[model samples]
Target: MLLPTRPCGPLLAAVLPCLASPLAAQSTDPGNSEPEPAGPTIVVTGALESRSLQSLDTPGLGLAVDADQIAAVNAINTEDVIRYAPGLVVRKRYIGDANATLSLRNMHTTQTPRALVSVDGFVIANFLGASFDTAPKWGVLAPGDIARAEIVYGPSSARYSGHALGGVLRLETEPVSRTAVSLGAQSFFQSYRYYETDEDLFGYALDARADLALGSGGISFAWRHFENEGQPQQWRTVAPGTPYAAQATIDDALGFPLRIAAQDSVVDAREDQFRLRANQELGGDWELRALAALLLDRDGTSEPKSFLTDGDGQPTFVGIAGVTLGRSRSAELLAGLGLKGHLGDWSLDLAVSRFETLDDRSRQSDPADLATGLIPQGGIVTDENARWTTIELTVERAIGPHRLALGASYAGYAGRSRTAPVSDWRTAAPGPVRNASGGKSELIGLFVEDAISLTPALEATLGLRYERWRAADGFLQNAGARVDYRGRTDAAWSPKVALAWRVSDTSELSASLAWATRFPTIGELYQASLIAYGPNVGEIDLGGFDPDLAPERGFDMQVTARQRLGTIDLTLSGYRQNVRDTLFGQTILVAGPGEVPVSQSLITNIGAVETWGVDFIVAAEDVVIEGLSFDGNISWIDARIEGNPLNPALEGNRFPRVPEWRANASLRYAVSDAFELAASVRHQSTPERNLENSASSRCDTFFCVSSFAFVDLKASVDFGPFALDLGVDNLLGERAFVFHPYPGRTFVAGLRWTGGRP
Candidate 1:
């Protein structure tokens, strides 16, 4: 029988009318309505040019989740909000929300994220223009401590640099308005089906902020901390089966019911962070701002190997014990001075920053079981350091129905690293290895954009950007000596054009076209190491740079229609990204040392591919009720490689890890002035394709994971001197799995007291 698609009809029918009646009685300026009773429009790095939903000017899809959304919902992290956004997919390796990987538009650009992340206008991509995996853990700022988050989807190469191929996620913390001290605590319980196990989780957050105003200048400082130890999920192991099963013939003739073994693979994580910003008006013509921040994160996990089947229909054991550790520290200093006189339309920004990261992985078997050496009995450590310096000059002027902006940027990067040799765990004879790499690079870009208000209901935007980049003096992926792959520079000129026409007072039709390019990251080019979880028995080596490699280029287009009527807002968008010279991961059979005859997988670049998809959003506020509302988003995708070439299984096959359909919905009702209620459900469909085009789950024909739906409810009440909130997530305590076995039934409670009004 086909499983249930979704159970949202009843929830929506009950909340829609309540949201409509009251809004119809209020003002028509929906743009003027605040998301919260008392709070500013949620705007941050992602929405730099737009401050409000009505004033937002963009040709892309973006989401701004305010701090209030976090506080009222008792969110766990950024993942909670992003999980409901359109065109984004997330899959967890083990379970829980801790160690999951996210993909956008079927582009697994990088192992982690090719997407860029920044805060306060500072780029968070590491030295190689790759999303810093270590950045998120700099202690997660409590939801109450956040001001807003800006998520820009689709290619934005014209404005943001690097991983702009996928998109950019910029997080902006709320500025401290007054002195305040707040504390909150929450907990949850989760379960899984395959393993027949349950998880108990708990966490808390504490925040302190102070704002000081001195001589027409202001300084604000804030600190945040969060910690949680969740229960582990049981892993399903392949039981010992006959040769028929091992040879892939079990589906032809089934004899006995399948039996499986189970193992527990749980995860634990923690984080802490601090931030300070000072803004001062220097004279009447200049404004200066200085910002400083620090962050930290740690996660631990224990996993098992796949069930080994010998021809006898008996189970054999192969276990692995290891821990993955990641640590990163970043410091940045930026000064933005806007001229108020003379060249009043010009602004200058200068920045200097440093980023450092260390990743250490250790593995071992039962120590006594040398015959089944699951983990190579050794450890791998990688140390990275990067320095960034930039100077930006921008000039903006508004004339009649036209707005012109021109900018030029010059930036330089330097990176260095060291590696140690892998030794046998039994011997423990390891000394400091030699330096593997050191490199320096420079980038320069000149950009210009013009926004023309052709008519009261129409706007046109034209933009162009010219960029040059080069890298030299880096180590080879094969640990030996540094290579002189330097003096390499390439220049590209890209353009973007967009037209937005307002079909009616509340409807808009828009289209955009652009060209974008992405360069190889330092990690992909210079870093090489052996991964344990590869197809090969020995070590899976990540190869080094191919001097003939070229930049990946793409021509992308998108069309969108958005309409707002009374209390309902609907949006439909379709996009296509045609990429040339796309780089992909390939496994190559390389000859091993001596007569070993070993094989390994290496990374390579692919020729061409087309990724296309469509997304829809239907959000309504008071359709029938006064204080009730609901919103839902859905997405569909179709992506594949052009001509079947090197990889036959993948030719004409759907891209790996790209789910065709995913959706989410939420319902909210304000019971009274001092109380509110909310309920939400999220759903993601099974994949209609292959696993990187290789294996398929025995439980399902496709690489498809089982579909699941989770429900949540929250309530808040306020007395004269204090306010309190209680929420229940995964209310049914179902043994569900989305991305992975997420926390089952869970709940959280928090309290807040507002003192004197400013």
Candidate 2:
């Protein structure tokens, strides 16, 4: 099925000012300016000015990164540009790894649904699945095309959904002010050493952008192609003293018959992206914008361990013990249209968007070892597709001393997932279809907000949002048996209040209280159950779909203070959040129909959890020297599971993957307008054990990861229309790990060219 396309002609026509009305209103005020008093005005400026207003009026903590700052970072991945933001972390394992997601204060890295990521108000999060594997498509926007990025903390605004429980990241693309063109290229290399494997790999990207003017409108286009080869990171583990190891013949190079070692693993990935945007200023306070984007990605992984042979010259390794190869290809598209205008005393903004994964196909082959080499075995193949459509309409006006705003939103999603076994790569003969699932979801939200000026130096804000969510058309199949699931529907009401007091000309204090609810994704409600095989524990059955799963609700409060003295600026904030019905996946032992013991992993609603944290930031420019500056932020968080009904022993356990302390600092020195150098450091404390807080947490064994810090240096020089940048990351060669060891010191260099006027 194809997604529906919308037309904006009628919307634009309706908002355009009439000829007679403009003449009557303008003429009457032309000669009366001397006597007319100032009244409330609706400010409808460009995107940059609009963002400034949003940052100031929002009732929460926020941070902004402009173009100059983004350029100074010289980041390869777009996510890397925000790495220094307070209380935010990007779980990017490597330069080209696709399974990256954002982690915020009190939120675990694996919780992909806790935060919202968007480009120009259009969501890029992959709602197809709920796991970390379904992170937002950050590739849609290249780093060179970003004009600014805004990060808002907490769920204190009526404009967003419960997905903002952790926070929101909004990326705004640069608009074409005049004819402009740019071309950029980057190359990076990393040397990795883990266990017995040591190797060097490299990656590169090519980007180009152009903007043109058309009559009263402008159009812009950007393209980027990236490719990379990554080193082996996964280590295969086998018991040394086991019976199987005793029988296995040892390879001369490997000292032991069976041991934990890095296999010959390698990954190669490629991506291509293109984006086009057009904007026009309709006469009389009306403007229209449209955008279209497409992305294509292909990735392949290969693992071929040392060959081992037994008697009769027959290779013994097979199945899970042999060579493995996997490949996946995917494509995504995003399109949207927006209109903003004024109608008398009311200002309105309307937007409609559609995002779709057109093709998602993957193939995997595990061959058995033979005398000739590796023999092909029947492989597994899967395909998935997802689509989302959203519509938003908002209106704002000033009534007396209060600014009132109201909005309505609708979002819908549909997805399909299927898996099958293939006999051969050439014939592609399918044997039996195994797991299959599909579902659809709908959401509707209405919200209102009022910002009132109670006094000359004090202000108050109140907001309320009502949301209705429904999941339907869900079905799952396993072992040739299919089941139709019942549909679920729910509604929630969220409220927020905030106050801001201007203590002095350069200082202010603010506080906010809010309550929000987050709903479950389609995958969490409809995926099929399966039995997984483990080397140490044999087989474990993982239960899927608990239709009765409840939503998570959070109550949050925060206070913030901002002050500036001379050339130094400081910000301090403290916050606390309490949550009910926290959802978590746990393993439990159950009895099958045959009285056999089975370990099942299922998602359940835990009782309660609480988190508290503090953040401090300081920035100074030209403090004591001519062109020297410093910027830094430090955060400390404490999160614990307060209660659990099913597992009483876990009453007080720290949250998994959340560090106690995290900090970032950077110092920059500018020799002149054309050259600059910077040094940065990042540190994080050790995290808790696992979610269950089992005895396994207290170990320095293979599964344990420790605290670590990293330092980086960057330098850039600009001449005429050309610029060159150099950087060295992980300068100390720290081998850090968050389940997987990070790369060693890496070197990067880039050249860029820019032309045309602003």
- Report lDDT per candidate: 0.52, 0.71
Model 1 worst lDDT run, 10 consecutive residues: 39-48
The TM-score between candidate 2 and the true structure equals 0.87
Best by lDDT: 2
Model 2 spans with C-alpha error above 4 angstroms: 1-54, 241-258, 303-323, 367-376, 425-431, 532-544, 591-598, 698-706
Whole-model lDDT, model 1 = 0.52
In candidate 2, what are the lDDT values of residues 1-758, reduced to their tens digit?
A: 11122221232223322211100001122311122212211111111121222333367777666554565574888887776777877777777777887888988776777788888777787665567677788887887767878888889888888888888888887656688898999998988875556678899999998999775778999899998877664554433543233433333222223354225466788899998888888987787888788989998875544333345655334322445567889999999898988888787889898999889888877454333346476677888889999888988877777878899998898998887878764247555776778889888999998878777656788999899999999887764677777889999999999887655444456789999998877877775555543342322122444866898899999887655445555566889998888766766556655777666677777788899999877666675898887767899999999988867777788987788899988788898999999888888887875777665543322345446688988999999999999998888988776665666788989999999875
Top candidate on TM-score is: 2
